[model samples]
Target: MKRTTGQLAVVIAALVAGSATAQDMSKIVNTPHNMANLDVWGVVIPENQVCLPCHTPHNARAVEDGASQILWNHALTEQTFEMYTTAAGHQGGQPEGTSKLCLSCHDGATAIDDFGGNEDTFDNVMIPADRLSNMGTDLRDDHPIGIEYPPPDLTGYNDKSTFTGVKVVTINGVDRVECASCHTAHDNSYGKFLRQTMEGSALCVECHDK
Candidate 1:
């Protein structure tokens, strides 16, 4: 069946609108990750450049051992975290890989505006301690980040090879869970930048057999 030009035009318009909506939903500016838009934190972002705070095209900062450089521009955290040891015998160690990158701002020690090697702008503007985002250096109370997945001896975890929603970072020949495993830095469509929704503990059960 041949369609009229008007029908084709309507179809094109619908496609364009859908594309735009998806773009808007994935934009970092629409999420709290956009440092330039966080005026409530009193952070005076030197410019409107959104990606510059965490990423850069050149002269990027070097990441710690066991982590690959991701054109990172933000300062790395130096705090030593006290990791958690689960009752099931799983133990977490010092954070590495993308998890450490996240802690650069979330540890409540590094300033949110202390990127691009700039020293004069908001040198002390750290994430507020009261904010839930600030996980602080003591990670004993939070979910283990740098721990081995599908624990060598645990029973509650699902097989890592069969996971579809979350990912684990392989650092120094060990596949371990990192901050990026649970959260997507650029998208907040599901809220809290979670890669999946938490309804019915869906996200939690993605890795845990429980």
Candidate 2:
């Protein structure tokens, strides 16, 4: 029987929790069941790798600017991006939430094998550097980040009718709803840790309509 996404998340989380050491993470990746699932996200991480990619064994760094979540070895990507929206909701900057972690590899600027706090120059890494011209510094073509979900002006909006609740996440004393709020880094019931699955235009409408 095919396991539900929730079930799979539970299993993956349990595996990570049980193994506290980085070297032991290989067991979770090598598990026959999870190997297939990891492929779904296009995660090409190899077995026998350290757990720091997603989890940490000791003194894991913070994920956000001020928050204290267990961050792995990879230096978070610091690129600004443009989000999709017809309204002028996002005004300040790009979203950094979990996307920072995603971009550490997907941005095509950093090496996949690069890790630890050595801060060595890119020339030293064995993995070849990515040379994709399309992966430019300007992220207008990519998804946007660092935007507020609910604007201050919701006079015409009905929260109840929209099937939504107010989320109070404050970063640097400023109220904002970022990509990480709706996503998870460890394990999630939905693909890519999205709060909900986006089918057709439904996903876009969930946050855009309001």
The candidate scoring highest on TM-score is 1
Per-residue lDDT of 71-133 in model 1, one digit per residue for the tens?
Answer: 999888989998888787676777888888899999999888888867665547888988999
Per lDDT, the best of the predicted structures is 1
TM-score per candidate: 0.84, 0.53
Model 2 RMSD in angstroms: 9.7
Candidate 1 regions with alpha-carbon error over 4 angstroms: 1-23
lDDT of 2 at 117: 46
Q: Judge candidate 2 against the unseen true structure and give its global Cα lDDT, from 0 to 1.
A: 0.50
Candidate 2 lDDT over residue span 114-206, tens digit each:
555435533222222344422444565645555544566654432423533223245666555554545544343344445555656444555
Give all candidates' CA lDDT scores. Answer: 0.84, 0.50
